[model samples]
Target chain A: MKDPRLLAVCCPDWPVVAACTATGTALHVPVAVVDGNEIVSTSAVARKEGIRRAMRRRAAEAMCPELVTFEHDPQRDARFFEPVAEAVEELAPGIEVVHPGLVAVPARGPVGYFGSAEQAAERIVDHIATHTGTEAQVGAADSLFAATKAAHRNMIVPPGRTPEFLRPLGVHELDAPELVDLLRRLGLKTLGAFADVPENAVATRFGGPATRQHRLARGVPERPLDKRRPAPELAVTETFDEPVERVDAAAFAAKLLSERLHENLAARSLACTRLGIHARTENDEELQRVWRAAEPLTPRGIADRVRWQLDGWLTRERLTSGIRTLTLEPVEVVDGTALQLGLWGHDDERAVRALLHVQGLLGPDGVLTPVIDGGRGPREQVRLVPWGDERTPTRNPDHPWPGRLTRAPATLADDPAALEDENGREVGVTGRLELTAQPKKLTIRGRTREVTAWAGPWPVDERWWAPDRHRAARVQVQADDQAFLLIRRDQRWFLEGVYD
Target chain B: MSRSATASLSELGVNPASELTSTTTDHATGRVLPVRGELAGLLPWGGLRRGSTVSVGGSTSLLLALLAGATADGCWAAVVGLPQLGVLAAAELGVAVQRLALVPRPGSDPGPVIAALLDGIDLVAVACPLPPSLARRLTARARQRKAVLIAFGAWPSPDVELTAESVSWNALDDGAETLRRQQIAVRSGGRGSAGRAKNVLLTFGEEEIELPLVAGGPDRSDEPADAGPDRADELAARRATTREQPA
Candidate 1:
């Protein structure tokens, strides 16, 4: 039997449309969605003013001065297009969303019911336009590529005329721009010229990418739609016969489920990089979370992540009901390589496993990794955050901190101690950021210490523009072999930290 | 020397079997990463032995000084339950910032924590006081995994027990205030080996740490002993530039 005809629906400038519509901007208003510095999509109004996709945002704005700019959010675009996809799904039981603003559906079922492919295409487009308040163009052809290209130009190609329709199209329509550019320089400018090259020659010269492009240029599906398998459920699950209310029980179960999942993945010579742990309570309440690793997850690493997730959900989330089902899904996977140690004894897998296990028991924030950051004070300069978390320091290290101290202390005290003078008078800073008294002594845990040597009161008055301002004078003092950093602020003396 | 002709000849001429056989040398026995120049003479093997425990006492600076070399050499080091560990001091002493992992408080009992760190890390420095039994078990685990365990507080008995004695501050003189130098007297002795007690002097300067030349070792002098990988890279780059320059 002949393959079922395919219908493609596409919405041009969907990101810009979604961004403008979400922000309550009119369609006639100049709008553009930018990814990084480059404009990803431009509205019809903006495009008319000479703004285009792939143009820099600054250049686009230069062309269209009144352009409403938005940072491109693929998640927001997909979220806004869900209703449009659902509208098509209603008419065609099984439709594939190719991307945020495009979808492909087998036309046989919908068109047979609607009497004709053109009638089916019109019905889908009208349903989406009315339901989603977005303009959509639809086309039907024997192959998805032809259908998509037809919708791209707002046309429909008859079943047997797909190749003829694709022939006059530019080689760039094959979507491998690098190969197309090279072929164009060689004077193969049209899809027909690219298609005329033998498949063997394309494979030998340009490899997999060019071969796929050549097939697409021949009006054949890059990969046949029927050859595509439904994405496999790569998750492992454990359904409790009786609900588990205790954290220990859930943690134990998570460990077992994690091992089982890892074993299944390992059998296929794959490793998970991003993992998702899901739990459903007896009352149907669900708790879902995703854990990402700096490196691939080992069996022990997976167990530790799952256990930490369970500990967090059970203790912190405070669910009303007990957990009835638990699932561990590897959201991302890569080919597994042999876990080999270098001659210098650097074993990353073992180290990661150990760290993950520690994180599980101590909580995610228990372990801290230290990074050298630019700041004046010892505590300010060293940034310590929970291990495995990616935190970019909010303060720019490169910015010059005026009146900042030069040397960092050896260690920062967990809590500050009071500083005093030789006469037992408290050392303090005045309203004008001046030291009230010389700091010669420090008292810690009832132990009075006298400084043998001392340095200046370097005043640091910062953030006077803000409501909360910091004003202090720092002094470095040495007592015997130990050195200390003392701060006097607001008529109070505090031991900032110590030198090793 | 056209690119296409050279590539085709190389592809056809290369013997795959000989290449594979030549590359397959047994590297199963993991070697201990060498220590920095300053502390290299202190250890018997010129480095911390893999699958061994070393007891570190006296000061946090000493513990950091011992680790700075191995960590700077690209080994991953994790400091567990060492809350008072001055990470800035470690960075200055020559530990690689990217290779060091700090777990200030690994809970009351850090057995599992230390074990996990030992699995993957080259050196796991644990400062918390653990029970004798637990310490023994962890040491055995370290031996099994071929990882080094550095005990900051105390352990029952370790292969090497290094203590910093007679530490004196030298930079603070006549109200100078800038503590640019320090002198530390380190004593080394351990179990199973000779009870030979050795004393060495370590000088901590602004940029690097060094050891004063002993009576017999005239070649050592006051050279920067703990010069890190940065120096090595600079040397490599200088050598490359020299090679490129015309005579």
Candidate 2:
């Protein structure tokens, strides 16, 4: 069998499992986890007290009474780690997530591209540590399973020893309940055991499943490279094993539903930009809410949205007791792209999100792409817009945009002396225009500058349309010497953009 | 590494040779015990390598550091007495805390617990309150599995590795001056069999760095003390805390 890249992940908590399943790939690396404080990992006392890995918190406590617990955020762990995965992607093609704790990537191209598999693995580990703020160990091998085992083993498998490396690992590394049980029944405890078993007999005993077990033991290919495709973006509806009533039951159902939804998304490289949730009560009534993935579109974010949707739908909407079924749909798709962290391709998603917003506002042709425009003024010469749709990139494509001389300002002073340069020397913002230095009004230089060319109060009414959809007040302003366009949205005045 | 095998074997309920080979078998030879099989690997002796006591003086960062590398090597290690070991810290540190034991104390006496571990257990930590005598005994038992015994400071045992002395390179903030995480100014007693040693310069990144004041000597060569296996300066400058004596 040819060598297949293996990505091994170890997610000891349910949140990790939920996150992993959402992403679709069998691999993941948890940055931080919720309920980590309570896990009774391998320890002298833990062994004596009879605790086990992947045991429920309550079960672990039962084994060793008084087991203290810690509640951490898995979302934070996922959020923190997307950068690492993105960083690794710089070295290879798309990552194939095996679990929330593991991912398998093709090694030939990366190794050959970088001159050697060892160097690539080393670079990946270093990049992840520096770019994503998480310490990771990367191993490359001919097979996905072998690679996963090697990674968990923390020994970067030299190109040739993948099969030899896997020989010693136990079969349970597969961690699939029924498969593991069958293998155990056959006394095939280790990869060596499966490797030693006759392929024909093994298949006869475990049927089809055993063949996979054999191939994995031999470092065989499981799946092809991760092809970014638009799989069916669908809704998941879960019915209780037993019909459940009560708001708590409904909430629990939502949690389960959200976990399933996230698992599907994670497995397929997809994220729902918009969501619509529905609950079927035991009384046959339905409670539903049309929502959005909100900010960042994380599993926790989705869960929060579900809870918020439930709260309003249940209390404000006055839905009565007990929900029998719950369904969630990914109404729209956004770039929810996997993160790339590091110098190679570590572009911040916040920047992407901002660009997406700009693109949405100005049709594709209305916005211009980011171009390096070096200019002397405060307004940046760089203009970013929706790709292909020509809004002509009217936004300044010049360096040192006015008002935000550092990042691209909204309004500029008649005289540069009025700018605030407190920490300017370091950040390159050399002006000292403290606009609010006195009252709500300020003197730019000698002349008092007031609001000039205006737009909003047009109340360009938004969600005027969707309730709670008003994000900010976008006021297009143009002063004489300085052209200013400001957005007084969400109570703060940010130069929504500049039109120099 | 043997500890993890033994643990998994035990988890699978597989029984093995019921005898302790001479003090040199790479993995411990024994009957697999029915436990979650926590295999925080031993140093190939029996328990924690000496000089492994990290001062858990209430800082979460330090506490997590203590259990972070419990399984850096493929060993089955168990922290018996330290029940309050932070789970999140351990997980983040790459230590699988799912099999940890939350015991008030391992046995009626720390000696018996040590004996149980020494009998056949691979890398079991019996967390009794640390005293010099208890540290010595626990350290004695750890010699078999080459296990690491990291006891808390409230039980300050003289025998364990005082890791803070080795890794802290920066100066300390005291009345006289301040210290960085990269260097520490040492004060020694200069007495005893270990010899009179005073004012030792302690540098960071060393395998083991003691305050150089002990009745016997130092044991800072363990892998966990200085995680970087690539430092020679760390090997040459190791000093025993017992070397500190009254001149």
Candidate 3:
């Protein structure tokens, strides 16, 4: 079967462009957007100075000493490209964004309207350049993948000649690096050469994924598009009584809407791959953006995308009023079986349901799970995370924390205690780590107990270089059958934990 | 085959005793969650029986130790209203903290919260006090759900009641060294098979020891040994000396 004809719009070095626009850097300046320590994208000027994608930041800096760098942020890229997408959408009504920098639209409508594919491409490119002040290249072919490749080189492939256009392209065009390397080693250096292999041979030799790539090389759709019109009920909408002006409030609403959308999809044995977020402000203005992912989106993934989109709209875009209505729609979906749970362990479905029910009764923070974090004191070592939230420790537990108690107390307490010497004088630690007087009795909450055995004054001088430096001494004292972990600070003794 | 025919066949040759034994064994194994270490001796079923309510009093470490074995074996446990529970100490006692949930503050009434947890979780330990009527209803719900309900304080009536009679710390004297271990004398009493009160001395921290086995009781020799040989030998010597006296 023949693939549908589509037109793709590509913006070269979009990340660099987005970074420049966001920071108001001149377009002619050498700029690079870096992720971690590697340069992910470079401007045209930076490329001329010997800086390339995936190059070390230090090496790039050494090549172009005047280069300006920005940390790679996908939200910023999407925010800056919103205007460009708006420009393309103005010319062609139905456009699907492949990503922040690329978009695709069905070729039939624009081609027929403009009298030819080339004219349509030229018109769209010209419109985007004039409206958004960003240079764009447009190409049309029998498939979106081929059109994307064509757009990169500013070429238009004839409708029936996508395969002929892809023939001389390098195997790297398949975008499967490992498979391309293998194909290169096997002397299949171009798409035509790889496509020349028999379908059965390719299947038997390279397995399933390679078979799909083989079909792509042959210029056919990898899989039959099974686009289904999602049920109207699947779209979750929330109308707030009060307009949401805060980012946190919008994030909370986004989380709820995403969860509801996920539940709706999961109920029908479906998972969304493309999601559309729409919002209506009190000023009667409408905002929309569609996000696409290669894999099906989990609830958390959907929530994060919605949050980022909302953040971009509220902060970056000028709005006369706060958002009044928010909606989350699943634009495309796949089989829910793709979202698999762990097969080995016992199912936590029951516990999760019960905890969620409890959370309903007493907010989200009522139910929590403990995570052991790194610290010297017992209280600082454990952090309680909300039940459904990610379980990440605030501090790394692998660090060697000297002066930490080897034996942790079974119970933590915040009680005030007084230590007295033989003559009923308050006991204190001296500057030289000496005891002013031997502790004989410990009084807690008006109850006096004799101290049988005690250990002392393990001083912890933490953050000594900072202005808010903390200086405290810990002592372990055994009063009869109960042991107390006492901390001395500001000339007062407090009970931190009890060995019960 | 008809019901009467199967009954006639059973009457002719089937051994009813063997059938009863097999059913009882399956029922016991399916209904109980295993508890390891010295604390296992305190329960009548040798583990935590489903639908049963157990009360743990006196020592927080003892409660954490009770949860350690089951949680380590992959059981999910939730603790309600235990804000001061030293989670690090629970980890030290061999509890899998990942499978454990904490509801430090369950609001004014914790009945519904604990009921919800008992319906799904394998075990629900509650420190908040409940009215006698509500406790009874929760016990019934626990039985229906086949989950264990543990009360950290007094309950209406529990299947097993464990109390730490006395506790003493070891390996420290006059600040020379840190505390290394603790010996707790736990006394277990309950209804039915556990009606006869029993006392067992358990050693916690560094090394765990269950000394002076009850006569005719289940032997735990087949359980995997987690302590070193020297520690095991020392425990054995202590066990021998303790066995000479009545427990």
> Clash number for model 3?
0
Cα error of candidate 1 at position A422, Å: 2.4
lDDT of each residue in A1-500, candidate 2, tens digit only:
43445433222333433333345424222211224334423333344566556565666666666443334443333433444445666666645433234545666667677787677777777776676544566766666667666776566676667778888887788745677887779777888778887877765665544565576687755432332333455568877767654446555666667767765664444555556677787778975544422122445456656664554345434446556677887755444342211000122222223222322232222222323233312233433332222223233233122111111221122222221113322111101111222112212335434433332211222122234545323233334433333443343444433222
lDDT winner: 3
Interface RMSD (Å), every candidate: 11.7, 29.5, 11.2
What lDDT score belongs to each candidate, Candidate 1 first?
0.67, 0.42, 0.76
Residues B1-247 of candidate 2: C-alpha lDDT, one tens digit per residue: 1223443443453433431221333333422211112221111122233323222232222333334343443333444555333332233334433323223334445555444443332345444564577666665665544444545444444232222222221221111111112232222221121122222232222222222221221344555532321121232122121122211
lDDT of 1 by residue, A1-500 (tens): 55746888888888987787779988888899988677889888888898887797888888878899999876567556666766887788656555567777777889789998778888888998888778999888777788889898877788789889989998877655578779989999999988898988976676544665777788875442222211256688899998988768976897679767865765565566667678999889987655544345656667766765565566545579889999888765664431111011223445544555566566556667787775556677678876654444545455544434434455666456677677878766544333466667777666678767765454443332233656556667777567777776655667777765
Instruction: Give the per-residue lDDT digits (tens) of candidate 3, residues B74-102.
Output: 68899999999999888877889988999
Top DockQ model: 3
- Please, what are the lDDT tens digits per residue for candidate 3 over residues A1-500? 33388898999999999899888999888999998678899999999999988798989999899999999997788777877888888888778776789988878888889999899889999999998899999988887678889999999898799999999999999877788999999999999999999988986687545766787888875333664667777899999999987878988998888877876775576767778899999999999878765445656668878887787788767899999999999887765533321111224556655665676566667788889887767888898887656575756566545445656788998888899999999988665344588899999889999988776555444332233645466778888778888888777888888888
Fnat for each predicted structure, in order: 0.42, 0.00, 0.55
Model 3 error, position B166 (Å): 2.9
Please state the CAPRI-style docking class of candidate 1.
incorrect
